[model samples]
Target: MGKFDDLPETRRRGLERMEQVYGFDMTDGTGDFFRYTADHLFADIWERPGLSDRDRRLLLIGLLSGSGGADVLGIQVPAALAAGELDAEELREIVIFLSHYAGWPNGARINSIVENAVAQASRPPK
Candidate 1:
C-alpha cells in the first residue's frame, strides 16, 4: 500500500481535521507544502495514538508564541475555540501560565493576539 493508503481511515480523518482547523486547501496546486502537510503533518503526526486535539492546541499556542508565529495563530486560536478544543478562558489562562516560561514579552504579545482573535471569532459576520 502507498503512504496515503497505509492508513486510509487515519488519513481521511486527519485531512478532515486539518481542513477544519486550518482551512488547508490542496486544490490550488500550491506546492509541496500543502501536500506534505496533509499527507504527513496532519495524517501522520496528528493521527498519532496519544495527544488530544486540545493538547495539540495548547502546545501549538506556546510553540507559536515563542517562535513569532502570529499569522499561524490567527488560524489556530479561533479554530481551537470553534472546535471546542479550548474556550476563551482557557486560552487566557494559557497565556498567563506561559508568561513565566515563554517570558513576559512573548506571552504578553501572544495574549494580545489571542484576545483579538477570540473577539473576532465571537463577533457576527458583517
Candidate 2:
C-alpha cells in the first residue's frame, strides 16, 4: 500500500482528492521531495492532532504572501480552495498584508495570481 493509506479514512480520502485535484503524484518525474511530501507532510505532519487544514492553509498563505512568490501563490491557491480552508476574501487580505512589506510589484503580481486562481476556481467544472 502507498503512504496515503496509513492515515485516517477521511484524511486518506482527502489526500487522494488532493492527488487527483492537484496532480500531486510522488511517483511522477520529481524525486525525493514529492515522496517526502506524500509519505511525511500529508500522511504525517498535516495529520497531526489539533491543527486544522484551514489553519495550515492560512499559515501557508501568510508565509507565501510575505515572501511574495507569485508562482507559488498561483499554485497553492487552488490547493487552498481544494482544502476548503481558505477563500477569496481571506486571500485578498493576505495580498494586502504582503503589499505593506513586500512592495507594490510583488504584491500586485501576487494579487493578479490570486485573482487568476480564484477565477479558475469559479469556472464550471468539466
Clashes of each: 0, 0
Q: What is candidate 2's lDDT per residue for 1-126, written digit by digit as tens?
A: 977666656556546645753545533324677656555666567667896767876677667777766667776777777556678888788889878887888888878987887898899999
- CA error at residue 101 for candidate 2, angstroms: 2.6
lDDT of all predictions, in order shown? 0.76, 0.70
Q: Which residue ranges in model 1 land beyond 4 Å of their true spot?
A: 1-14, 23-28
**TM-scores for the candidates:** 0.77, 0.70
Q: What is the lDDT of residue 117 in candidate 1?
A: 70
Clashing pairs in 2: none
Best-fitting candidate, scored by TM-score: 1
lDDT of 1 at 109: 80
- Model 2: how far is 49 from its true place, Å? 1.6
User: Could you tell me which residue pairs clash in candidate 1?
Assistant: none
